[model samples]
Target: MTRLQPLPGGLPERFHVAHAMEKGASRTRLRASDLSAPFHGVRSLSLGEADTILDRCRSYVPRLAPGQFFSHETVFVLRGLSTPEWPYVPRIHVSAHRPAREPRTHGVVGHRLQTREPAIDVGPEGMPIENAVRAWRQCGRLWGLDDLVAGADALLAGRHPIASLGDLEEEVALMGDVRGGILRRSLALARPGVRSPRETHLRLLLVRRGFPEPDVNVDIFSTRGEFVAEIDLAFAAWRVAVEYDGRVHAEDPRQFARDADRWAAIRDAGWDHVRILNHHLRGGGAPAVAMVRAALIRAGWRPGL
Candidate 1:
């Protein structure tokens, strides 16, 4: 018996099964344990576990037919929006517009999208993908109210924003009773210029608890017209500012000193500043609301019925 010839090296990292066979790969060699079938009719050189979502996405790219693109939660991660940290890997969300058969493979949650709705766009990887508006709208399939708002804020206000408040409003109107009104409620509460999901949570916690909605990331100026600071959640009318200070990044001494000076200046300007940390929002967020409420009251805000 002769040892079978190894597969050709120049066949590309991920190759279609038919293409490999046409390139002189023997059926026996193609069926060997050396190649793993990540999807039907597509094989890959071992990328063990495919731990990250993008890796898994690329692994399945060979099988994506025309008109099919990534959507929903997958787009959230791919586009760098905040999502709940799961202990295990989540399935990829693949989608195609109406009349197309959606994928039903393991490790995939396929969506049959509305025809010509929730528009599509190209992603950073050059793959066909759902636009940020569509992704934010589709997240209603799996996300809750606060998360939906966070995702909305990210799409409309993040660096290199893909949508505007008008875009979101348009999408929500088209949704037409999606989630039995969850999308409508979230959209009404969603604010632009929100920097992070934690900020969204903080804002929602206060409003739901009867505090007035705060202006998101608005600039505050001193009596002399000099910019004092941009408060994360500014109650400008009452001279109160609420900010979520989740500084988990590696400390930059220069940035820290600048922040220290900024905080001091904010206080010196006679604005009541409420600094909210991770623990303040850990549970029911009552503490965060209470802290903001105290600051607002100190700044002369009165509750109304």
Candidate 2:
């Protein structure tokens, strides 16, 4: 048996077999036990090593046909938006500019674009992908109203937004025949400065249960105009803040300490703060909503007033 040379570290996690052959790897070596054939003519050292959905998608980019760009959940992954876990869909999504036969490949889902739709762009990793707003609209086919709102909020968040709410609304108007009700509802519910999907979920739970929609990631200041803290969701007048604590807060010692201090400061400022954990958000968010509702009542918020 011929000895195989070790793969170079400079090589991407996934590469074409031809590239490997060019780098002096023999066909027999490319087919070694350590290599995986993720797509036709594409090889990976370890499929498990491609931990993220985007990593797995990038592995197959060299094999994508002409005029193809990622869309739907795949684009969600590419744009760094929140997405479902691997095996949720278990297929890479591709969208072609023109009508084409659905790819017969077992692990791929293909879509056709409408005429005169926005042009696709090459993403940071050189993979072809739809723009953020367009991709958010495309995702409506797969995601429900709440998930879509979360996606839109992510797209239009922070000082440097990838896409604006108006841009998303225009895309929805252009794609008239797709996901009508869910798209409109998501657009109405979507707000800027939402940092994560869990925040969006918590906000939706409150509003859906008839609580006045709280502002997203608003800053609360001390009486002397010093910034006390920026809260996840706040009913400013009511002085109630609803915060979603992801696992990172507990896992990172420094963050946990900072959060404790921040909570104490907010409490000292005469604001009622509600901390929401992942478990409180499960099911219908009854416990979390009840907690926020109680805080709101204490802060002088009434349902019909």
Candidate 3:
């Protein structure tokens, strides 16, 4: 773990500026300005994360409109709020004070504050990024799920925890978004390394397409209390088990043998099974929804009025 250098006055050191000068100086001829104290009087704040934008704009302070606050996106990066897979966009939101201008041309964006909402104070530096991430969670309700997820990704990848981002994402996801689905919340509940990537994708697709959700990685056991098989996705009442089979399953000889044994064990326990391939779920073949729907119908899923 990289120990964060203790910041001066609890403010992030301008690491971005330092990184930029280092890069520019490395290229053949260095400028006179680069030799001088380019960061004179500029208290460089480290966002506690590394990035190209952070490197380029290290010397520049975000130009904010009079009373605008930092949006979830900027705060997310500054605070380290999300998983590494999440994409980070360099933008900040400022609340619209007077009549909003026609999208100001600054690098930072001015997002109108929700009516009657006061600005939330982002805490001091050197405090765990998690605290700022909590503030980002609150900001997401006014913004959207995409922003929130992006924010969470930035924070988490930068070494913050998912727990610190809080539960607002789950709450909003439950309420449904433009697509009238709850993917955000479902993703929040997904445990890393527990489910195969294929299984996780299928589960998300089912939820997105409005299928009856299945229990992920449910356990199966014999009447004699012996463990039978751990299903990838299971419906207990229907006795249906959906397994996501990846290409690796077909390629690896050892994995194939283990899978054969697992399948035999499952069959002996008298459970119905349906295997879906990753290509089928993710590619342009029979759509994931159709395949799942067919399986459910064959297993006697009644249509609701």
Candidate 4:
């Protein structure tokens, strides 16, 4: 038996078998028990547990052909968009130009395109990937209106946005019912400055219940014009704010202290603040909606006013 050579540095987590051969590993050693064969010609010594969808994707990189970009749910994971955990598909999604031949692999979803190639961008691994906006459009075929809105908000949020709402609108117009108009309604609901999917869900719940849509992540100023703090969802005119307290708030000590101080400042500024938890959303958001509604009413908001 030949002695196996050490792997070279700077290789990705998963690499082609040829790369190992270049590093002085014999084909026999490459098939040794220490290495795992993720794809036909790809081998890795440390293929971490394939628990999450992303963990599985790392194993499929070698099989991703040139001119093919990751799309659908795979792109959602790559872009860090919030999605449900269940319904995990082991198959990887690949998109390519017309005359696309679906790979013979059993666990891969191939999309052959007749229209002009969807816009392409590079992912974290420097591999060709579908741009965020185009990926969101592709996702419309699978996700519901609320989930799509959350995804759009994620794309358009933060200082360095992946894509603008205008960019998404343009893409939707170009698609024009190709996806059965799934993205059209979500486009209307999508807004900027939303920080998380839960926040988006809260906003959608309020609007669906006939409450005036609240502003997202707006800064509150004291009566003296000093900036108080930025609240998650606010009705500036009504001096009402709504916040979603996810597990991180209570689990992280630093965040817990910061949140306490921020809420105190908001209260000192004479604004009504409503804190929502995962439980509030679980029961169809009735408790949260009723709470926000009462606060809005007290602040002089009225229906059809």
lDDT of each: 0.80, 0.80, 0.50, 0.80
On lDDT, the stronger of 2 and 4 is 2
- Residue-level lDDT tens digits of model 2 in 1-305: 76667875566777888887888778887788788887778888774656656777877786777777777777777777876433455347887765543344657787877755547777757888877777777778787778888888888887899888888888888776365578988888889899999999889888889999899898888777778899999998899988998868577899889888989988887789899998897778889989998999998888988
Q: In TM-score terms, which candidate is top? A: 1
What TM-score do all the candidates reach, one by one? 0.87, 0.86, 0.46, 0.86
Query: What lDDT tens digits, residue by residue, belong to model 1 across residues 1-305?
Result: 66768787688777788888888898888777778777777788784656788887887887787778998888888877877544524458999988886788887899887777546777757767888787877778788888888888887685667688888778778766477888878888887788988988888888888888888998887778899888899887888888999876428888888888898899888788888998898769878878987887877887783
Position 303, candidate 1: lDDT: 79
State the lDDT of candidate 4 residue by residue for 1-305, as single tens digits: 76565666666677888876787767877777777776678877684555655666677777777667787767878777766434634246778876665455655677876558557887756766787788788787777778888889989899988888889999888876445576878888989889999999999999999988888999888889999988899988888999998867587899889888888999999999899888888768898888898999999999878
Q: Model 2: which ten-residue window has the lowest total lDDT? A: 82-91
Off by over 4 Å in 2: 1-34, 45-51, 84-90, 99-102
lDDT of 4 at 137: 82
